[model samples]
Target: MKEVKKMAQKCFPLNDVDYLAEDLRLFHAGRTVGVMQVTGNDFHTVAGAGMQTIVGKGVAYLLTQIDGLGGVVYANTDNVVFNHDVADALFNRYDAIIIRYDKETNACALKLIKGTPSSEPTKYIPKRSETEYELVIKYVYIVAGVGTITNSDIKDAILNEELCGIAVDTLAKIPTKQYDDQMKSWISNSQADFKKWFDDIKNQLTEDAAGNLQNQINSLNNKVNDLKDIFVVMEEDSYIPPEERKIGRLYFNTTDRVESGFNNEIRVSPNMGLKKV
Candidate 1:
């Protein structure tokens, strides 16, 4: 006798097949959610199925994985794991993940998820979130009579609080005495070189050499002026006492001279203001 053949069970019933297909298409198209606005530490939207849960848990996960240079993180629906080596590959592989930021925004945005590339619906777009981008602070000190000071030369000046235009918080972040000796040695050498250049200019020995010396002097002078422009002393009216100040605050102190007691006392002032709370 022939045995009866068994039919395999279908994943979905005939009526539900269309709905499942549509949902699958939506997932494949990456139409999971709209633009996610990250304002500070909070996620704006708590609606949608997977999105709501991801927003609540994944945001914190994204923040932790952010590197100093900044980048996007990816995860499966169930697990949010950020591995730098695999972020790009996983980002492309996953369908329902959010993107943190891109190079255009200076890696500032909180939610940079891939979607259908449509304008976010008015109802879904949250109020603009205030996000803070990580900044790389650099200190450039300009000396008037002396040539441009090296980063090493400015270390002591920075630590002593002699450099005015720099924010106090920025100053606090610097490694104290990291460049003190190096900067001092550089200043000594630079002064000696300046004297030699000055003598060459005054002697008027060879036109070409003198011209070159003069050009060097001119370049130095321009750098000094540029430094002056950058380090504008905070006006007395805007001064916030140190005790009450926050990070990224820009204030000027008239008393703090750039190269104090030097023949060319270039007064360093704070400018561009600070980014504080």
Candidate 2:
């Protein structure tokens, strides 16, 4: 009998790179970001409602993991790495961090003319150079600005009111109400359970990290407080007074004189959506 030889075959299931890309797309889809459109008899506004949620959650997750990272400066083109280390830190330190996506350009060949300057606008393609990207994080101030609401004030508002009327109305169209309720309940119960269970476990362990965990919890609580302050400012700017039927827009004067410790250069346009509502 002749010996038989078998040919080697390449096993090509999904590789790690492809797997990561798929996961990233899925994660992006899950957030309240990306493009949105509204159409119906009511002239529904389909603005990206999840934009805030996605940014908030993403920043929160990143913040917990970032230790000593500084403002990230990365390339804008092909090998773009969207690191959220600074975002995370800002999320923990400030009420809101505004992130804007900007377009980039490539360098062009220069031509010189005698006497008269070149009349043509610089040539710019939709393309960016290999390493051209910009990411900025603008921190939202609580209490010390146009509105007097402090971080503590926002938390007070939450506890005082039956519910945050503005947040509820904003999330009215969300299909994840059931999930949200479930998560809220779980968080409430888990916090209590962990306090007891973890205390017992910590006592038994040779080295207890309870102090460190508490510090982290405190830091997270501070972030929540900061957000509360921002909420009050937002409410003041946009929330319609009960006596007034029309929802008011939030207006900020960017060019106005700056108060100490506050930025005056970046003004907020009163939300046009309020009038439409």
Candidate 3:
């Protein structure tokens, strides 16, 4: 199921025109978050920044000019007196400024100040926010008729799109069937090589097994004979039946006491001699 995003929240209000210049000073040269049209009859609108537009005519045209100028516009309403502090605020906060157009005077002027300009990328995060280009359209409509969304709203929209695209692109990079096929081919070749090595080892072991057993048995027999002195030797004269001399059986005694019954015992003989059944 698709999840619904929370409703948009604004970090700053865009409706208040009084702080527009101050906000621009801080955020500077970005798209307008919201649009405010000075509608009071007392407002004697005059151009304050980069370019000018007639105060009462239409906001769309003014926004277009601001877009072209690539800055925020601060036009005074007829009701308010122009404050130098406002001008200073705009200069500090925004890159370019437009004064309200006076149709009667036919004058729209731009204010210029000296400072190092900000990098374009920093000025507007192209992927994260609306470009100066897009804001013009959004602002003009907001100024003229349709109310515009806040700057925070616009930023949220951009962020949402960016996140979605990143997810999709990352998903696309996952390994596919083609990669699995290549891996399988490698594994098959490795298994074949391993099987050949195992077979060669088995053959070698089979060929050596008989010789290995014979060598081991001979070594054990030698070890038993080395300890023959410890056994009792019976002379022919001591034989119970006065047997003639030929060979004497050497007997060994064991003092081992078994607490458990023996399951089995192994008997060995010299090479070529038969083993006890």
Candidate 4:
């Protein structure tokens, strides 16, 4: 007994095991390509003429759970133009948008393969082959008489896997604001949420033993007011009022008038009287 192994950096299958193709594509494109092309919703279909199903931009190695071997191939380079016209008055049927990979040539391309006509939509069989690996990206249900196919008629097959996903950021998904008639911008939806950041900073400063900025400014003003007690000033001639003469107090006394201006004497009170320096 031997264990089956797939090659590293590539997928491989051993001969004598009629499961060659299936084994090779088991992890083809690594189960999910993760929505490679962002443009036009990644291979989405648009409602159009009954005979024509428009597939939007598609570029990825696509697959589905049921497409064991044929579920691994590169899809169309761009939007697909393919006809899935009514063969007759169809009761109902499913059509697959597949990426066909020809192993012999190692070339991959897109194709719209008609599924087995089914009265029950769930019973429709999509394309699957060994040589030409047909990876079904989507299952499109053809409405009666081939009416316009909308998004509802198409079954997105990517989400079949746990990591299978599609993400095309649309303006509708975003919260935006129009700046003016000719301009637009994104803005905060609520003022409280926007102002919470500044409020948090102010609150943190109070808890950290560092007073808030407003408190600091008020403290500074108090300290400036206390400076009045440090020194008292007298601006006059040498005659100073007896009560005004105090130690460390300074006086600017006029000496004489000069060409520039009146000269002043600098005197400091040493005792109860002012002494000229």
Candidate 5:
């Protein structure tokens, strides 16, 4: 008689032995939580700071992107609009603009977290916790005598996937040997296959809207070129460690969204992303 080894919950051709809920939760738990550009609408859309209102595109902040979701109840995303006053000379200080998710209230909204006044003169960012997952979008520095906030006054605070050890496409490129057929199809398809997939999804949608979104990809104008335009940043300057840089991995840099010269065999890019049935 020979001894046999048992497999994990996510084995392919999942059946009675596999707990689908547990598998999904485990999958979602393995990734970092942050705002992700899911619908090809906006990646980091945000603008404004004044007595008037600021504008930002709707955001998706959940494991549903880089990680699998345990379950989805209902999530309706929309653009963000905020109003803040830049302190005029008298009360110059640092502040943080954040998107906060409160588990207790089941609410996700934008908030301005105030920082200590005149403390070493640095940008302000809010604290994050298990219950209150705050994604800091921008750090603001209110200058004395200036009531206006400019690009120079704002700094990006979006969670960096590199720093978090969770690339945006990490889940997309997981070992397909263990994933179900759909996951394998998503991960293993080439651009030509991807174009067909894109066309299929588009066909299911209303022609006018589908045409627009499909055109958005076909034209390669609106959406970020996640698959095609290889990020050209030098690997030496990347924050990723040398050992972590592996072939067949897609790398993203805020400045340069390029692959780190790793994958020469096969280029795997995330899907163009499909919405409701």
Candidate 6:
């Protein structure tokens, strides 16, 4: 008896439009591996053929533009028994999937696809064969879309309560406008207050400096007056005569004192007393 070997499955490349459609389908289904951009009219012609053509016999393609979220390319495969499971899974996962045609280029791409999880998981059964059970497998395709998603789109989605699973009424609950105005007013007032405080400190410093300089000048004037007092001279009446002064002696002549002999008498006397003039 001879032993047999199982054959390996082969992979093939999809057309540009089909690839674009597959990318859209995965994006809408939230199973995307990455994103791509489709340019030119060729994208439109095939997308116009509808989901039947987009999905093709065993696989389908879709494309869309996204901004800000970043770009990637991705795909997946799972073995299953029923075909309806794939459709059910896709429908359950996605909230909405939009397909639009660009008239200018006569091309169509997946514009947007939003997704949510299904309430229940898909059930599968094993196939029985003569020798054992066999598991069937299915392939899911994904590709890139045309254009890019922008930050503005994300902002709009957040504001509109379209993204993040937030309710529209919840966003309306906050007073955004009032809060913004209050914040601006508070900032302006704070800046004004800081300026006033800084000016006050500066003025005080200037005044103190002037006061210190004046004090130094007054102290200097008082020192000068004290110095003058130390060097002051006494009144003239208080001065001692030079002849009577002990420091230096003086001599005086008396010629008319002798009464008897006026013509021949003359005397020299020493005057030791200080005299006042």
What lDDT tens digits, residue by residue, belong to model 5 across residues 23-118? 544544534455454554333434464532353564444432222343112223555555556565555676677665566686766777765556
Give residue 102's error in model 5 in angstroms.
1.3
Worst 10 residues of 2 by lDDT: 60-69
What is the overall TM-score of model 3 with all chains considered together? 0.22
lDDT digits (tens) for residues 97-118 of candidate 3:
2223333343433222212222
What does candidate 6's lDDT look like per residue over 106-158, in tens digits? 45333333333345423222222222211111112211221222212121111
lDDT of 2 by residue, 232-273 (tens): 322434644435443332323233333354564543334522
Question: Which candidate leads the pack in TM-score?
Answer: 5
Q: Rate the local accuracy (lDDT) of all candidates.
A: 0.34, 0.29, 0.33, 0.56, 0.51, 0.32
Off by over 4 Å in 1: 1-204, 238-277
Estimate candidate 4's alpha-carbon lDDT, on a 0 to 1 scale. Answer: 0.56
Q: What is the lDDT of candidate 3?
A: 0.33
Q: Quote the lDDT for 28 in model 6.
A: 37
Stretches of candidate 3 exceeding 4 Å from the true structure:
1-171, 221-277
Worst 10 residues of 5 by lDDT: 268-277
* lDDT for 208 (candidate 1): 79
RMSD of 6: 26.5
Segments of candidate 6 deviating more than 4 angstroms: 1-167, 170-172, 209-277
User: Which has the greatest lDDT?
Assistant: 4
Quick one: how many clashes does candidate 1 have?
A: 11
What ordering of candidates by TM-score runs from best to worst?
Answer: 5, 4, 3, 6, 1, 2
Per-residue lDDT of model 4, residues 113-141, tens digit only: 77666577652333435455444567778
lDDT of 5 at 270: 46
Flag the better candidate by lDDT, 1 or 5: 5
- Model 1: lDDT equals 0.34
Instruction: Report the alpha-carbon TM-score of model 6 versus the true structure.
Output: 0.21
Clashes of each: 11, 4, 23, 0, 5, 36
> Model 5: clashing residue pairs?
58-78, 58-79, 89-145, 231-257, 231-258
